[model samples]
Target: MEFTEYGFPPDYLDEISSAVQKNDIRDLIEEGLIKAKPIKGTSRARARKADAQRAKGRRKGQGSRREAPTRGTPRSTAG
Candidate 1:
């Protein structure tokens, strides 16, 4: 059977023969010939560094402030 008959494109192969049968494909997979690619983990280098700096109180300065400072109550003098 044509490999494309199963919805796979002509070039979408994982090192297996293009003219293989379904049972043959299963056999190859069972025998460790057809292996799936491993999933990649997200990198936390920058995030971990930021967390470490935050633990050391490095990012709490006024320059990094998010809110405006509150004002004290006003006082008035009467005549």
Candidate 2:
């Protein structure tokens, strides 16, 4: 099968074909032809968990208070 059939980048086709013809299994392994074990969870699940944790840490009213601007300076505002 052509490398493009396996969804590999077209530029890597020559190297991939050479490796296969040379019996260089390392490249195949790196390309995930051989599975070691199934991942426990989907990447989407992991990403969601990470995003939730980050959102929790960014909860409103969590950080040090800024000093109120003195009368002369313009107060900075959020959009």
Candidate 3:
């Protein structure tokens, strides 16, 4: 309904949606909506790219590095 990336249906959605309960993800999963499989993430590729970029003098700024220490951190809640 909101039509975000995860919310909106993809290209092959019609075939799957035709069978499952309309607009309901739970029902679709419960009824086994065309055997959807989880795909592996590209985090490794992204890490490699970041490494390459950093090697080329990118993402080495103050924003990239940790500006503060965990031990010397500020406490949000007073105990």
What is each predicted model's overall lDDT from 0 to 1? 0.63, 0.56, 0.60
Q: How close to the true structure is residue 47 of candidate 1, measured as C-alpha lDDT?
A: 94
- Give the CA lDDT, 0 to 100, for residue 54 in model 2: 69
Q: Listing every candidate in turn, what is its Cα RMSD in Å to the true structure after a full C-alpha superposition?
A: 9.9, 12.3, 12.3
Candidate 1, residues 1-79: lDDT per residue as tens digits?
2335443335536646653788877876675555565566999999999989999989987777777454232445322
Positional deviation of 63 in candidate 3, in angstroms?
1.0
Tell me, by lDDT, which candidate is best.
Answer: 1
Residue 61 local lDDT, model 3: 68
The residue ranges of model 3 lying beyond 4 angstroms of the native Cα positions read 1-42, 67-79
Task: Provide the lDDT at 2 for model 2.
Answer: 34
Model 2, 1-79: lDDT tens digits are 3334445556655655677543575756677543355446756887787679768874333253355435335567422
Candidates sorted on TM-score, descending: 1, 3, 2
lDDT of 3 by residue, 1-79 (tens): 2232444346547855565455566676665543454576666888898889999999976667776544344686423
- Per-candidate clash tally: 0, 0, 0
Write out the backbone clash pairs for model 2. Answer: none
Model 1, runs deviating above 4 Å: 1-15, 62-79
